[model samples]
Every structure is written in C-alpha cells, then in structure tokens.
Target chain A: MVKISDEEIRKMVIARLEITPSKRKIIIGGAGAFTKKELIEKIKQHDPIGQKIIEVHLNYLRSFKKQQFWG
Target chain B: MIITRPNHDFATKYLFRWSQTVITLAKKRNILVIDLKGKRASRVELTKSVRKNTADFIFINGHGNDDLVTGYNNQILVQFNDNEKLFRGRIVYARSCRSAAKLGKSCVKKGTRAYLGYTDDFIFYSDAASKFLGPSNLIAKTLLIGETAGQADQKAKDAYARTIQRFENSSVSEKDRELIPYLQWNMEKQVCLGNKNARLKI
Candidate 1:
C-alpha cells in the first residue's frame, strides 16, 4: 500500500496553497503518466522517483456546503 | 479554438460542462468555436480537425497523464511523439495532466505559438451536484477571450487568488473548506510555455 508522507503533503499541499505564487517544476508531459493511485502504488513498491502525488487525483475530493452557494 | 471534452467519467463530466461554458462564451464574442464534445471528442476527430487547419487555438478538457490526453472513455486522443505537430501554428491550452511537461514544449518547438497547461496533473475541485462549474472555468474563459496568453494566464491566477480568499474567510467547516489547498496546488502547477507573448486573434 502506497502512502504519502506528512511532510510531503505539507510541502505540496500546505505550502502550495498558502503561497499566492510559488515556484514549481516546468517539465512537460511524457507518454502514459501515472494516475493518482497508480503513482502512489509505484512509489510504495519502488522507492524511486521523487514525483509528487498531486498528479494522481484529478479532482479526488468532493464537497457541498450548507450555505446554498455553488461549491 | 478547438476543444475536446470527453464526458464519460466523473471528472470528465465536469470538464464537458466547462467546455460548453467555453462554447457559449466564445459564441458571445462571435468567435468560431469548434468543439469536440462528448462522443465526438475522439482522436480521429481531433486529428481531422487539426488537418483542416480551421482554428488557431485549442482548449481540451479530459483525463491525461504526462504525455497523453484521452477522449471519450479514456481513448488516447493525443500523445507524445509526432502528434504534437497538430498544434503547430496554433495556441493550445490543455486542461489535462502533464501534457505541458513534454507535449507543451514540443508543440512550441514544432511552431505552436503558445501552450498553456500544467507540467503535472491539472487538478481542480467542483461541487459533486453542480459538477464542473467552478473556478477552473476561469483559466479557459480568460484564455479564449482574445487576450494575450500571458495576460489570460495572469487573470486565471488572480481568479484563483480570489477564490482562495473566499474559502479561507468563509465560515464553512474545515472539511468543507478543504479545497483551498487543491486550488492553490492547481495555480502553482498550471504553466505556460512557448512564446509567452502569444494570444488568440479576436
């Protein structure tokens, strides 16, 4: 089972969200890149590739607030 | 602009809705919009449309990875290698995954005026009920509104900032407010390559 670390989440999620504009990688796409779950599993199996897990979930979470506003 | 929107899955359903929004907005400006929506959004159609050279901009929404973007039911629409030349002499904004990583650059090298997308996965949050109608729509709309690619990109970033502010200051639960980080991640991941100076002709 693949698991993302807390610090990794902090950097990719927390820092990414907190900063208005953050520096990021600029490499273009390659053929058949891994999905969210696939990337996680790969990372779990072989501790290579420092790729971030953000690419895995295209829009993983879903929510609707009670304010009746469009989420 | 040529847009490909495949609406087979949950995420794609939202993207298809967003693509329609783009169509409506583009039509308002009297822009000739060629949309490969739903079932029509196949690789064959995409290649055929490009061969016709009928448009100078492309805005695609669907599932993709580093070098490939799929259409209906995750059918491989366009991937790396010789296919990127399909974008030559045009501006492209792929709302897919890491198409920008290599495909975006290759498109530029092959003569695409500008390419806008994430060097990684292009993620966004949407209401499950309302689907894809979210701030994610801002970037595509801003790009097709006849603004410079760079300017449109800036506007998209600004819109993201505004949305972030909205979520942060809202009284919603921490669970409901969980989208801020993902929103921020998309902003950071979204990238522009090629001539930053490129823009669509109105």
Candidate 2:
C-alpha cells in the first residue's frame, strides 16, 4: 500500500482528535512538546520521535477498526 | 517517593495540573516528596536526590522512550543505560512514554522490588475549552494509598476502563471517540514487573 501524504496524515490526525491547532493541545510520542501545527511540521520532517508519533496515531486508527492490536 | 514534575511545555503542564491532587494526597500521608520542578528537574538533581535517599518509590511524569525518562528541557533524569544503578530496591512508576519497555525491566534486573509503567505512550486527552482531571485522581489515589503493587496496578487498569466507558457514554463529538482507543491502549500496556505485592515504605 502506498503511504499517505504528510498533509493527509495531519488532516486525519486533526479529524480524529477534533481539535484545531490554534487553540488545542496534542501530546504525542516524540513531538509531545509541540502544538498542532508544530507537531505536524515536526512529523513531516521524518524525525524519529515524529515517526513514532505518527505510528501511535496509526496504531490507534487500526485498533479502533479491528478492535484488537499487537497482543 | 519522588515525583518528577516538569512543566516546561503544554502537555507537561496539563499533566502537572492534573496531578495536583495526588501531590496533596501524598503530602497528607507524610510521604517524602523529592519534587523535581523547573530547573531543578535535571539529571544531576535527580541523580543526587535518588542517591541521597533510600526512597522506595519513583514516579516520573515527562516525555520518554523505551530507555529513559526525561525532565525539564527534556533532560534525561533516568535512563536504563546509565541510571539503572540508582533504582535498585525501589518501586518505579513512570507516566512517560515507553520507559516500561526496557527501563522497567532494567530496574527489576538492578534489584527493584517492582516497576509499574506503560509499555507504550501514556496517552491522554482533555476538553480544550474545559477542565478534565482524567484518571489521575483514581489511579494515584489507589496506587499511593499503601496498596500492594499488583493491587495498585489492577486498580489503575480498572480506573482506566471506567474512564474509557464514561467517555464512550458521554455526548462528545464523534472524533472524540478516537480518544477511547488510546485510553484502552494505555490500560492494556501499563504493566507491573518483579514483585507484584510490593508496597512503598512511606
């Protein structure tokens, strides 16, 4: 499967969280210290923590669908 | 007991605010609190504090990975590679990322009585427009009220379940439902290793 674009990933995360970047707080793995836009930009850079942040949200996404994860 | 509270950013500050009640409860029980706040929350200060006391409990709240727990300015307060020696004979509970993945086992190997923490990121959410304490109240109350480590771990899991259920039943937006998976993930990943029945010597 082709990987989603960073923009799409950001939108998916924001839609999943239902929080705007301007006034909300989001805590993730590597970019836990960054805000919405900052976190998106950080993740876009493919940093290690940023990758983990994306992977965590993806894990949640998958688990919410299959109702189970790495057991 | 030592609590590493670093409020240098938004998420840390949010967690720090949520933990005010737990801090008060521990103080009420006369637990020795080596609070690492602001600039004092550095590796040097943490090492000194841990070395200076025969403290039985270590509770850290910050960002971390499988090998370490960070502090103010993301300084490594405890890392498995370098700081495993400091946690011997202690019960460690890290509310950070993945410290339990490797650091917890390292502490157990280094002779800790028990280590309780999340194998994944300890995720949380809040109403940006309102205040929500999340599970900190119940989890901390149960875990710090002199219960066995195993019991405390179970209580925390139960609290997580109840909180998730509450979120499901609430009339929040659909996107908010995504938060449930994270809560469930945290509940399932939070683990206890070594002595299950250990208790803090507070």
Candidate 3:
C-alpha cells in the first residue's frame, strides 16, 4: 500500500469534490446541506463536516478499490 | 405505526417531507399511524406514543449520532441507556445518521424486536432527495406490507443498488451520476439489528 500524508488525502478529496456542480448540495447529518463551494471552504477549515467529507470520500475510494459495485 | 417527522433544518425538512410516502403507504395498508410531526416529534410525545402503542412500528426521520436520535430542532428523542427500552417488542427503522452504531444496538439489547438504521451518517443530495428517500422509505413500507425486518432491510438495499446502477449508466447525466457515491454510502451503512426474522405485529 502506498503511504500518503493526511494533507495529500485531504487535497485529493477536495479536488474530487471540486468537479461537482456548484448547485449541488449534500446533506451531512445534523450539519445540514452544503454546496461544493461551501464544502471546499469547510475542507480548508478542517471542521467536523470537512473531516466527514474527507472520510466519506476515502470510504468511497476504498469501496471502489474493492470493486464493491454491482457492475 | 408511530412515525416522527421533525421539520426544522434543511436536512430534517427533507426527511420530514420524504417520509410522508411511508405514512401514506401505512395508511393504505390499514395500519393505524401515530404521526409525531414538527414539535410533536419531541421525546415526550414519542415516549407517550410508544407507551400507548406498545406494538406500533416506529419510523424516525431526523438527525442523529452514534448514541442518540433527535427530532424537531435536534431534540433528543431516543438515546442509548436512556429510553431505548421503550422500543422493546417493537420494530424501529430510524432514518437518521449513525444511530444504529450505538442506539440501535442498545435498543436490541433492551429487547427491541428489530432495529434498522445506518451505522454512519445518512447522507443525500438536495436535488435528488426524493430519489434517495425512495429506498430509505422501503424499510418502513416493506414492514407495513408484512415483510420481516431482515427482508425490509434487504429490499431497501436492493432498491439503492438499482438506483446506483441506473446512475452508473453512461446515458445518465453527470449531475445524476454524482449521486452514486452518496447512495452507496447510505446502502453500506444501513443495518438490521436483533432478530432478522422479527415481523411487525401492528
């Protein structure tokens, strides 16, 4: 396994989230919904929601790595 | 059937509206529904309703964490080691974030027949809330239609898989395709605790 710094992972997650449309809003539990721009700012701020988004992205990547998709 | 719909913030508002479909289905199935909507979704009301309707299947829609599920304005409704015992002998499907991690387990330990919920934060997109909710609602809808808790859990996951598959298609718009990750997250996090064979009595 390749060792990546936490900063690198955060950057990767933020970059991936950047491609999402600006109008799109994702609801993350009680923190409510956030647009891509807001999420990016949160990521930069390293708030709980930002960390959550990072975790979510990492989890999705792991699923992709395991080929968990039906296809 | 007792369902709580807390329409306070954006997240709860979406859940509140989307969960109406399950209520409608319950009524159509001739199941009596005790709806705790808005301020009525408080812990007091939920406790009273549960005590009164001991066998009512509970469908909770709100924000939550590993040890507790909330209602309107984030009021704590059920919590681990607090009032989870109230769910004993009843089936509960909590469409809230992370409650299954601790609260659901506590409920099961306290004798809840079956508890279905997410082990992680339950997420969805605002533009496609209804589509996401369609699968989420299946837990309660399937139960109301006489499926066991385990079967309802599988049916909901299958619905999520079908939705994700549809979005994975090349013909689908990129905007819609963006929803697949969140869909997969919810599907993977959803869990059925206690007796998988437990069926609703009401």
Candidate 4:
C-alpha cells in the first residue's frame, strides 16, 4: 500500500481546498475533533487515498496541539 | 514507453512525438519500451501486461473524463484495472486529464506509490502544453532513475515554466500572450495527489 506522509497530506489538502497554510490549520483543527483512527475511517468512506492522507494530517495536528500545550 | 492515442488525429501527432522522446530517454537509461498505441488494447489487456511485467513506472496518454480514459469504443474505458495484487508496487503518470481525481483512489489502494494527473476538466490547450513541457516523460525518467515523486513533479514544473519562458521570449500577438497566461494558470491548478517521497512496497 502507498504510505501517505504528512507532507503529502498537507499538499493535497492545500490544493483540494485551495486554501493557505493558516486556513489549513483551522480546518484541520476543526476536523481534529476525532482521533486519527476515526478520521481515517471517515475519510475512507470517500476515498482510500484521502483516508491515508487525512490520517497523516490528523497525526500532525494532534502532535502540533500537544506541542503547543507542552512547549 | 507504452502509448495509446485513439481517434484524435491532432492528439495522435502529439502523442507520437512525446512517445519518441520517452522511448529515447528510456533507451538511454536501459529501460524497455513497450509500445501499445493503435493496438486497441483494452484495460483488461493492459492490466494483464502490467501483471506480466513489473514496470518501474507506467505512463498513460489518452482522452479521459473524471472517471476513466476513453478506449477505442466509447463503451469501454481504459484504466488501471489491476487489483492490489497485480500492481502491488509502481508509480503511474496519468497523462489523461482528471484521471487523478478522487475516483483514482483505487490506484493507490492497489499499491501505486504515486499517481499524477489533473484534478479537474483540463482542456486540450493545457494538454498540448503538458506535451510540450514533457511532464509525462519527465515523470517516467525520474521514477525509473530512482528520484522521488516530488522531485519529478518539480522537474516537470520547471520544464513547463521554461516552455512558458520561451513563449514569452518569442514575438507573439497580444491575444496569444493572453492565452499563454491562461494556459499557465490552468497548468498550475493541476494537483498531484500522492506522497512525493513514498515508494510502493509490494
């Protein structure tokens, strides 16, 4: 299977939404209400590639939030 | 360099030129050329060939809609029909426009590391520009030579930009200049929807 990385998700989401990085952060933060696994399931319902990508983006967002709080 | 250019005569001319370039490049890199144009090969046939030969990279050039590429008959659609087992590891460059949309997710599910194409209805002009820019050939060369998808894509973009620069340098009418910008804009809007550095693992 194709391993979708965080950078790939970032580029795909940015291109799909035609938004900037700040806007991506906002949309991802809103979407991050669910866990990485849950987001993957939801995204898979639409597109498998999208599912893998969303999982990567969710992981990034989760870690970013954690880092923001801890560091 | 397997190719399939159907009824469109203008597109066929462009495809032939592009195929020659790819074949020459592949020869230089010691890659075999599996030419399949005008053979009326169906998706099933192509799938079988893909299964038989584990190609490092696959490049398809033809007319396409959001769902599939047009085969000889309008009733048939030429696409990568291999299940996860057949094409467990490969990178694909879909020269057909809109073949990389959400509908192409199955390609990745079937184990393609990267699939590059347009996200929307790309026009014939943009298709012509892509040919002139050699995005398909560039992608093939990069993948076969062990470069990342992003690297290949960047090279393709640079090639395209260089073409635009050449057009800008040439003496052209105002109307043509206006059209050139539109073409560049459309090309920029084309999105690559896969992991740039990811390699398919069978």
Candidate 5:
C-alpha cells in the first residue's frame, strides 16, 4: 500500500467533516458550539482546535489499524 | 455533597441541565446536598459552602482550563493555588476541561483525597448529550454507592467503551458513527488522580 501523508489524511478528514449537517454543532470545552463550516475554516488555518480535530480523526483511523477500540 | 451548576452559555447550559441527574441520584440516596446553581456558583459561595458543610463529594460542572475551574459567568471558582486547598480531605469530580492536568494535581497535593476529571477538552454534541453525560454521571453514581474513587473511574471508562462500541456497530448510522472520534477523545482524556481507594463518607 502507498503511504498516506498527514496532508492527505487531513484532506480526508475535512471531506468527512463536510458531510456533517450544518445545523449540528460541535462543542469544544468553553469555546461553545462550532458549526461545521467554522470547523472547516479552523482546519484550514491549522490552529490549535484544527490540529485537535485532525488528531481526533487520525486517532480514530489509527484505532482501527491497531485494533484498539477502547482504552 | 456539593455541586456547582453554572448556566451562562450554550456549553454551560448543557452541563447545568445534565448535572441535575447527579443531584437527583444523590438526593435519592438521602445524601445531604448543598447545590450552588446559577449565580450562587461563585468563588465566595463555593468556599463558604465547603467550609461550612464539609461535604465529602464535590461535583463541579463548568468550563475550565489546566489551572482553574470557573462557575457562573465564567467566574473563577477554584484555582490551582488559590482555592484548591479548600477541597482537602474531599473527593472532587470536575466535569470540566483540562482541570485534571494541573488543578486536580494541586488539589491532590494539597491533601484532597481524590480528583476525577479530564486532562483536555470535554467535547460533546447537543443531540448526543446523554451519551457523554451518561459515562460522566456514572462516576458520581458509583461513588455514592460506596465504590472507591478508582472503581468509579474505571466504571465510567467501561461505560464509555460500551457506548463507543455501540456506535461502531455496522448497523449504526453514519451520523452516529461520526461521533465516535469525539467519544474516543473524551474517553482517552478522562483521568483519575489521588488515592484511588478514597471513598465518600456517606
């Protein structure tokens, strides 16, 4: 299998997030609710929250690879 | 038992509402509860309540960072060095973000019996509030029933695992499957510090 880069995984994460309903909101700590569009913008900027989102998605993918479903 | 519910914003509103389950569970057990809701969830009020009541369990629901946990209007309630000492000899379960990393440690170092919290952001969606709160609420439920702090933490993590498994099932919807990453993040971030054997006086 060809190795996938972080940027590729990041784009895939963004694409996955695109399917999220606009009305649905993701609340992160005290920052309150963030719309999908706003989260996409954050991902593009690669800010702290964006990096966190990327990490969350990547970790979820890695879990399947490692067969570590629960910790 | 003392619980702080700060209903100031969208995030806190959900916390405030979900924390009622904990309060109800405690009340059902006939435990003496000193609930500080809304404006009463302030620094001065929390100090006074802790000093006077000496409640064995402190359940705080609010937004927080590594160094401090806030209450109503994001008012600083208990900070790392400022008021963490107030929790000495007590078990605290802060349903806030990142407090376990710093403040929880300080509380333990200051003589707190146990501290259960998340080391990073506690993320959840509005529609799936119960899914997140269920595991969190389990900590208090198990503790109130004579389980040790460590046992309670493990039970909560087990609950999180079960919930995550359900969402990962092949028959589950895509929308629900999307919540898996956040749930796993929360499960990974949850941490238990201090004496795991610590139990509430009740």
Candidate 6:
C-alpha cells in the first residue's frame, strides 16, 4: 500500500481545484469546520489520497454557515 | 447552457442576465446555445444531451457548495452514480461560490477535464456580472476549441482584469464608484480555478 501524507492529500486537493498554495492554505486552515481526524478517515474510505482536502473544505463550509461544525 | 436556480431570487436574476449576455456573445462567434432549464432533468438527460449533441463545453450555473449543486426543493445535483461515468471531457464553469474546492477529486474521478468556481462567498454585483460575461465567454470558446485548462484560465483572468480596468475607467456616479471597489475586491477574492491540466476528453 502506498502511504500518503496529510500534506500530499492537501496538494492533491489543490491540484484538483487548480488553486495556488497560498489560496489553498488559507481555505484549509482558517475555515475551521474540518477536524484533521475526521478528514483522514474520510480519505481512507473514499479516496486514494488522504483527507486534508476535505478538512479544509469542511472549514470553508463552517465559515460560510458561521457554524462550528458540519451542518 | 444548463442553468439551475434553486430559490434565490437574486441569483436567478443574475443567472438570467448572464445567460442572455453569454448567448448574445456566443451568437456573434457563431456558437450554438442549447437551453437546459428546470430541475426535473436527471443525470442521464444531462449526459445524453451533452454527449449526443457534442457540446464543446458545459456551464453549470447554480447554487453549489464544495460537495454538490442543489436543485429546487433541496434536490442535490450530482453528475455520477456508482455505475455511471458522466461529465467526461467537459470544462465545467460552476458559478456557485466555493464549489470548486475539494470538488476536483470528484471531477477527476468522473473524468472531467477541469472545473472552475469561486473559493468563497460571492456577491453578485451588477457591474461584476457584466465584467464576468466576457471572460466567461472567452473561456468557453477556448475550451470548446480544445484549449487546455491552464490556457483557458489565463485567458479568463486576463479578461477579468480587463473588465476591472474598464469598470475603473467608466465614469459612473460616486455612489457606484464607492461600491465598485468593494465589488472588485469581492470579485478578486472569490475567483478561483482548479485543475489546469486535467484533460477529460478521451
């Protein structure tokens, strides 16, 4: 099995979105909805890559709804 | 042209206007416009119409998040099912905010060449609508002719910048000018592209 790092998962997400690192980092870190653990689990189940991308996006949704967790 | 509007009054108006402008511009370039409206169409309908008709590019204008596009009555619009592979080889320009984030994996998995969308909440300013039309048209044209995602993005950004420049040059009233900067800032902030080289066409 190929081991994928959290950072690699992050990069894969960014690459898929066609966004730069600067933009990707901001969306993933500051958005605040995604927990690192939950994302890793989702990645493990649904994707070849890991879960960093989902984590960042969870944050984005949280920020958008102004909610603390996934709605 | 597949325009899906949930219940947002403002977004519906903006999409209507944008669709009108796109159709007019496309006509000038001799491009045919296929109108796909309403929320009842299934994924099969979308794929068959697009593939059989051979649309060069597909534009999905609707309210979307990172995961899915919602239809009227909170119906989720998805391009693929467990056994079906759709949305292949098309450049999808999603007007919904933040719809492009983390959606790349799904798009890639479905075999779509690339996806473009906002990374944050977007305010549909009137001037921004006019400004976005040209760039959007150019991007569609390039994609239809087989330009790579990266090339299409550059062309689209250049068009967006030109639109900003024109907005600055226009002699609008002071009230509008003050709002223009805010609108411009939002436009700059929200615009994002993903998967520059994702080649979906087989």
- Identify the candidate with maximal lDDT: 5
Model 3 residue runs over 4 Å out of place are: none
Encode model 3's per-residue lDDT on B122-157: one tens digit a residue. Answer: 988998887788888888889998989999999999
Top-DockQ structure, candidate number = 3
Predicted chain A of candidate 5: TM-score: 0.84
Pairs in clash, predicted candidate 2: none
Q: How many residue pairs clash in all the candidates, one count each? A: 10, 0, 0, 0, 0, 5
CAPRI classification of candidate 6:
incorrect
TM-score of 5: 0.95
Candidates 2 and 6 compared: the better one by lDDT is 2
Ranking by DockQ: 3, 5, 2, 1, 6, 4
Interface RMSD of each: 11.0, 4.9, 1.4, 17.4, 1.9, 15.4
Clashing pairs in 6: A17-B194, A18-B194, A18-B195, A33-A59, B89-B200
Which digits, one per residue and each the tens of the lDDT, describe model 2 over residues B65-116? 8998898889888888787878888887777878889998998988988888
Where in model 4 is the C-alpha error above 4 Å?
A1-71, B1-8, B73-87, B124-136, B165-176, B198-202
Which consecutive 10 residues in model 1 chain B have the weakest lDDT in total? Answer: B124-133
Better of 2 and 5 by DockQ: 5
Q: List candidate 6 stretches off by more than 4 Å.
A: A1-71, B1-8, B24-32, B39-44, B51-53, B71-74, B79-84, B132-137, B141-147, B163-173, B180-202
DockQ of 2: 0.27
DockQ category of candidate 2? acceptable
**Candidate 5 interface RMSD after superposing interface residues:** 1.9
Candidate 6 lDDT by residue in tens digits, B1-202: 3434333344544554566655565566566666555454334455567767665456665565666554443345553243114556666776555566556346756776666656544443344355445565565556555567677666776665555455555685443343333233334444334467743242
Where does the lowest 10-residue lDDT sum fall in candidate 1 chain A?
A20-29
lDDT for each residue of candidate 1 in B14-100, tens digit (9 for 90 to 100): 667666777898888888878888888898999998898668888877777777777888888877885887888888888887778
Q: Please give the range of 10 consecutive residues that has the lowest summed lDDT in model 4 chain B.
A: B122-131
Assess chain B of each prediction and give its TM-score: 0.90, 0.89, 0.97, 0.76, 0.98, 0.69
**Per-residue lDDT of candidate 4, residues A5-63 (tens digit):** 75566556444323222211111210122233443444546554344344433543454
How would you encode candidate 4's per-residue C-alpha lDDT over B105-148 as one tens digit per residue?
A: 66777666777766544332322335343654676567666678
